[model samples]
Target: MNSDCVFCSLLRDEGAADWIWRGQGASALLPLEDGRLAPGHTLVIADQHAVGVQDVSPAALTQVILLVQQVSVALRDAFGARGVNVLNASGPDSDQSVDHLHFHVVPRWAADGLDTWPGGRSGHRLGTQWPAELRRAVTARQL
Candidate 1:
């Protein structure tokens, strides 16, 4: 466990973060910054200390995904949510604040002001052609 990682302490049950579900390789908790998002907004955290999905073991990732699915269903049924948003940020550019990998499961309702596509303003430029190097990278599977 990383000594400075708060998620590691949460996994060790050493923190005050309230757990909604706990598994061998994953756990679910209400995010400290949440309660304003939706009625059932929660975070599914990987049991292992990993910066992102690419850094976690396959077994642990599978466990985390399964828990995410379970929580999504719970949010829908328990909170009467019409839909759910399963979000994850992998790096600083993606707004990942915690070092450990986690999935944010947020319930969605019709009148909620949550914007599903926060980057919707960029849609107008979608018709622009991809750079040659980027096209080659995709074709060569370099990314």
Candidate 2:
């Protein structure tokens, strides 16, 4: 675990965390941030410190994803959520705030007023046939 990571400290210091579930690979909890966007805005964090999802091993990533699924269900039921959103930011360009790998499991309702879009959102809307370039790139990259 990285000593500089807040999630690592929370893992080491149980009293500082409010857990939905803690396990070998990951833990789910309410975020420590102030003025949460929505009720039951939970964070599913990796137990081992990894800067981004790409840095995590498949096994550990699987564990985190499973826990995210479990937590999403719980939060949905608990909060009577009409819908759910599971979000992640992987790299600096993606605007990942923390260095540790984590996903936001947000319980949502209609007109909840939570803005999930990143800052400086583009005004351009994707026309149906316009994304053919994206498809071509995916094919060229063999992704």
Candidate 3:
């Protein structure tokens, strides 16, 4: 494990984390005191060193998604959560605290009272408008 990487340090026991489950190539756990959002809310992280989703392979991405699904189901069942939010911040612009690729499985209850980002347009709509053919081509390439 690299000492410079916080996730790696956590995996190596150099840093402390409230670990829940660990498999061969990943770990699922709650964050420490300063990082936790709510009780039983957790993060599912890739075991190998990956800076972002762009660095993860298709197989690894599949594994991570499956693990996140498992955690979501377990959290909902165990804690009676109304729902769960599976989120990931890919790059620095998206409020990424750590560089490592990880997914947050946060359990949401009616009483928790978290608010989502506002969904209103600004001066103009952002992003390029592509034809269906071009969109299909891009999706195919992503696969």
Give the candidate number with the greatest TM-score.
Answer: 3
| Candidate 2 residue-wise lDDT, 75-142, digit = tens | 77787887888899998877788989999988889898877766786677987886898888768865
What order do you get sorting by lDDT, best first?
Answer: 2, 1, 3
Given candidate 1, what's the lDDT at residue 30?
Answer: 90
- What is the Cα-based lDDT of residue 34 in candidate 2? 91
- Worst lDDT run of 10 residues, candidate 2, spans 30-39
lDDT of 1 by residue, 1-143 (tens): 77799999877878798789888999999987634477678999998899898688888899999999999888878888888899899866678989889999989999898986677554344435568757887799643
lDDT of 3 at 108: 88
lDDT of 3 by residue, 1-143 (tens): 55688888888877677788887677897877677677777999988878778788778787888888888888888989878877788887768888888998888899787754547745754456557767788789776
Residue pairs with backbone atoms closer than 3 Å in model 2 (clashes): none
Q: What lDDT, from 0 to 1, does candidate 2 have?
A: 0.85
**Backbone N/Cα/C clashes per model:** 0, 0, 0
Q: Each prediction's TM-score against the native?
A: 0.81, 0.78, 0.82
Q: Runs in model 3 with CA error above 4 Å?
A: 118-137, 140-142
- In order of TM-score, best first, we have 3, 1, 2
- Candidate lDDT scores, in order, read 0.85, 0.85, 0.81
